[model samples]
Target: MTGSPWYRDGRMRYGVGIEDTFIPQERIGHRKLDEYELTQHYARWEADLELVAESGAEFLRWGIPWYLVEPAPGRFDWSWTDRVAAKMQELGLRCIVDLMHYGTPLWLENSFLNAGYPERVAAYGRAVAERYRHVWTDFTPLNEPVVNAEWCGLTGSWPPYLVGDDGFVTVMMQLARGMVRTQQEIAAANPAAVFVHVDAGFRYEGETSPVPRAFLDERRFVGLDLITGRVQTSSVLGEWLASHGVTAAELQWFRDNAVKPDVIGVNYYPGFTTARIEDGVMTPVRSDAAGLRDLVELYSARYGGVLAITETSLVGTPEEKIAWLRDSTAELTALRDEGHDIVGYTWFPFFTLVDWLYRYDQKQPDEWFREFGLVDLVRGADQGLERVRNSAFPAFRELAIRDR
Candidate 1:
């Protein structure tokens, strides 16, 4: 919190995050999948912050539900977030605030496709920056653009449900524009704000054809490339974007106002980050520390900036989780030794999270919960999810203490 910004402090910071997905169910006809509400975080946030500090972590990756804070256009409420920000300061936790995490206020019809999305989201970002400029300095304008486009656009699982290539391109363009505007507004409000553009690090292995392996690989960088002005009409991905209706004017717009991230945070899960294709059926293959190394190398070679493992965890037994933590951290250490600007690592969720499928399924939240945190969530007599420490908690704490 002193001299040159946390990233330039010459120390590897460790952090933990509570799952804060706030996708409203107004358009889907189901209960909202608010992680904080389902995990009782709204009531027990103080205790949750205590848990984060107890983990020997100096940083916390947290989020604000823009939909809740700005329930109606031009109206703002900071009562809840005000207290949360104060507590993080009191705990001495450096926060990487997620400004938009895949949801919009109900008033904005058609979700991301709303014609007013870019400016509206930018205004929200400016408001948040003005309010919390003194307490927080880092922000993720939007988390995982590819995943956002995948769920809401390509798969038609969420709002404005469009499908296929056109939908993906449409959603990506909107997200890219909104993200650029958000960064610009935040910087105008707080000059010291640091942007950590986080995205899911995806890997695919298989035959090249209908969707060539090279195209799939290049597509992974489209989210970052578009925001940083690396996409042009001459590039393979840019050409694909053009075929899907992206105008040359739009590409030029990105090039004119590119906002590069101070830190490129890549979220990867050994169990879910990689996929193998055979006969055109994509199947997820379990990855190892080597897989993470490949991604870190890939990002470092392409983006060439300070990097962080923004999110990593496994939905398995405590022993399995501990093994992953050990292996992945070791790989990171080696990367650091090799001169990669690896600044931080985060064990996301902090506790269990209700899987996204819960939105479409008719099952109790407990049944849909995934155990991928330092602590496990269990239903108590009062039916509230209780955070019970698992073996990985101590293992992670020891690692954090040693690394820090």
Candidate 2:
């Protein structure tokens, strides 16, 4: 804590998550998919910020659209983000700016596969940092890179959909490069800048036979390992990448320019975040405390950085969500007391968010709500989005104050 920023002081950093992810569609011909716009965040920015501040959380996992700001290459616009930066300062909410969530601008064809992707993303990160030099905005250059790669490269669910192991490695490398470059640029702009490397923390369990648990386990850490330069030529992941059509130069580049994270931000959720494979079928394992403790230990031993429960929320009723939040906080507090650098806890998505399955094709939920936020997104009689604070609000509000 001596040299680290004031925010990283050993005190637990409780925060509210602002769910903002934009995914482009290769299935639907290069169209943009924005969660913020779909969730009415653009229309209710001030209200949303107020809700986060009023929740008594110190940090907000915020995002701004790179495609909107950098409409075209070398041409930048800071109008929208300028206002956001000012408001965050006024509200006393420290932000962990998510520079690239999951998508790119329309101009960047093949998305993460594009050779210029790393440089382009780095440029945007640098521009944002320089523009907001006075504001103490921490950055998450890329969020959930492993999931981004798997969805875009392996499953053919997202843009530039490529269905193969080669595509997966390619996307992962591109993301790693972008993260490293973006960190470098942001740090150059402000030496005080800190980065919370956010990734989905998963634990895959199953029968020892039929499935190679070691392979899946090693693969889980590949994204973070590569970013931190842990993938040596003789390493299991490096060998796997070499066999999977990733060029020798690409592997060497990651080794040469790896960037370690300042904070290890683990995005944990209820279902499917921790899964078990029994007889080749995968299922969710429902023990938040056990999962959270294991993750804190794993990351603490492997990465040796200040850790954070960056995202955790349930989609059930308010009581159920509150129960999960309490359990999660207990685990995090236990870890912190045991001398682990577990610095923060976050209730992701302060309000209800629109479903990503529709990907902006449908305006709002027609049938029922996903209901993942502390507040519910209900359709009013006039058909506009209404923010209804659930029982979890007061509970989390009190918890945040007690933790501080």
Candidate 3:
């Protein structure tokens, strides 16, 4: 785990992740939402790392809040992160550090659309790599670029708000550029670094839909395609992007400086990963193991590299959660048996997290809490939110130990 890359270790790795999104901006009347604060992770980070190690997980996908770490243009405060990184290494847990989750520093004027975003984010990536190259080697430049663009561009819920397909394309271009530069910076610092490009695995269904299934399917891979330089003029999404205002030179820029992921981490939740779009309205369709298998196969066929279920879980009763753990792992095992390069499976967010809706509504964290982890969060009057281990904890531990 220390010298060689874990994905190259010839084992099906098992890991857990903490929900580490830090959107620090409040638009309209909405309040900012930081998962670490809501879950008290900052105060109890040591205990949280211990809990992850205790669960028999070898890896942890966590993020550093850029807004807090870099309050000024050229200054950084790594005191808190230095401790967390040290503790993670001490616990023998391999860290796949998430460099960007959603938000940027308040000092960054226009968020993702800012002309200097790519360079600024790359600078942060370089600093992180230089600081913790020994403690961890895996890095995710940004988590869920599609979701980032959706919230910030398509829906106009986040910073530098721009709506419609044009906005999404604009934001995606900036993200892809930043991601490429971030990967380059991290590699310059640590030549042996591994990049796990993580994104939400979106699946759209419905024969009589407003958006063509073919287009949506192709669109799902647009973010990944852009980074890897797969969106050429002859590609399916190439013309669509051009029609939206992307020029030939902009498309060629990605081709000239493409950065392919060592492992494509697709975050899939059976409860809401797949959807049915009808007459322009989209509805979440609850899917099961079969749905997961389809997504794994799709990504594998497209990227043809090491693939991992970077995030997946059910927000349901203990029984339902346990069932998903059994079913999903079984399907992945079958895929591995059939010669798929599926290297890892991660039950994301080791504990509960505040729902994203909490940011737009004035409600207590407990009210908007989601039970998607092996551990549950309970509100304590004196101690804030307490981490309580539920039945799924032991179940997931058993799977991790048995699988690894």
Candidate 4:
């Protein structure tokens, strides 16, 4: 198969996000929510890669499971990663390696809150980059830093589950530092590497008062702002960080050692992007082309870099997903025609995923899979998993053929 080249080659990219999240929870008795297990990516990785290529996607948003990579501090395991990277190269599939998804290795107690979190994560990143330096050229140091901070720090969802604004500030600062250091180490290892900084893009509307609305709007920019060194000492976020325990000197460190991304990646889920706070109840506003267009415009103006829809999918029937694929492509093409450097559009999760609720160990039903993939996961006659083609497959394949 003659697949498309990676984004750094100046070609527009169409990709799929392989679901890779490893979060060890103390609440569920220290049971980890491993997406690779839930999605059976371990046993079926090769077949999964075939599915991604068959679906016509040019790039893969995949990651090396961090827990397995650095099981113990300084102990590195490259067997699994070595095999996967070799296969991806042989298959002509460009990989946007997600260096850290959402979890840390267990040996690193306190996770992101650890004082050495930045240095430790950067060490792991440097090892991977040096080892695979000649093979891969793109990476995402940490996925959704703000969301990770909120869940692990403010909401008490993961390890070192601290609850308070102080926890949030602490985790955010550590995450920012980790990102900066990780990029630095990787760049030192592979000077030609491209860093794609990805985060959840959102806009909020308060149905009642202006105070909360203004707060939420500013808060949305916390992760990106901190990473880009755009947060001023007197800014709303800086003040909040100062009151919560982040020193002025600490904030200055990030500003002084800023790492700009080669590409700005936006993960937009209509169900989460736009919301209304009516009578203090948050409701998902139906998705529209305007929201997607607005994001491309907003980010292009702010970051002034090539933009890619890193992740976008609707959880619904096959026809609905197909419709979304067509609509999203139109919006992206329109943006490109309007002179914006919109370079890519992705339909994430090349195959099905276990319900995200499974992360909380919420046992629902045997049929609880989230059907957002181009193909569905089904039980084979031997009771193992099988890829059952969904209606959206042809729709996406058509778009990929035309766009590619």
Query: Mind giving the per-residue lDDT tens digits that candidate 1 earns over 24-121?
Result: 85544466778888888998899889889999988888999888899999899999999999999999899999998888888898899999999999
**TM-score, one value per model:** 0.97, 0.94, 0.98, 0.94
lDDT of 4 by residue, 1-404 (tens): 12442453455668888878787544543356787887788998998888888888888899888888888899998999998998888887878899888888878877887889999999999999999876788899998887888787887777678787778777888888999999999999888888888878777755434337877777877888888888888989888788888888988888999889888898887666788876656678777777888888888887887788998987888898888887888888878888787777778777777754565555732455877788888876886778888888988888887776
Better-scoring candidate (lDDT), 1 or 4: 1
lDDT string for model 2 (1-404, tens) is 13768556678878988788787444543345677776778888888888888888889998888888888897988888888889999999998898888888878978888999999999899998888878855899899988988888877678778777888887888888999999989888888788889989888765443557888778888889988878887788889998987777877887788786888899888766887876756678765678878888888888887888888887888999889988888888778889888888888877776666665354434442577888777777987787789999989989888878
Clashing pairs in 2: none
Q: List the residue pairs that clash in candidate 1.
A: none
Each model's C-alpha lDDT?
Answer: 0.90, 0.82, 0.90, 0.81
How well does candidate 1 score on lDDT at residue 100? Answer: 85
**Span of 10 residues, lowest total lDDT, candidate 3:** 203-212
| Candidate RMSDs in order | 1.3, 2.3, 1.2, 2.8
Residue 391 CA error for candidate 4 (Å)? 1.6
Residue 341, candidate 4: C-alpha displacement in angstroms: 1.0
Poorest 10 consecutive residues of model 1 by lDDT? 24-33
Query: lDDT at 15 for candidate 3?
Result: 95
> Which residue window of length 10 is worst by lDDT in model 4?
1-10
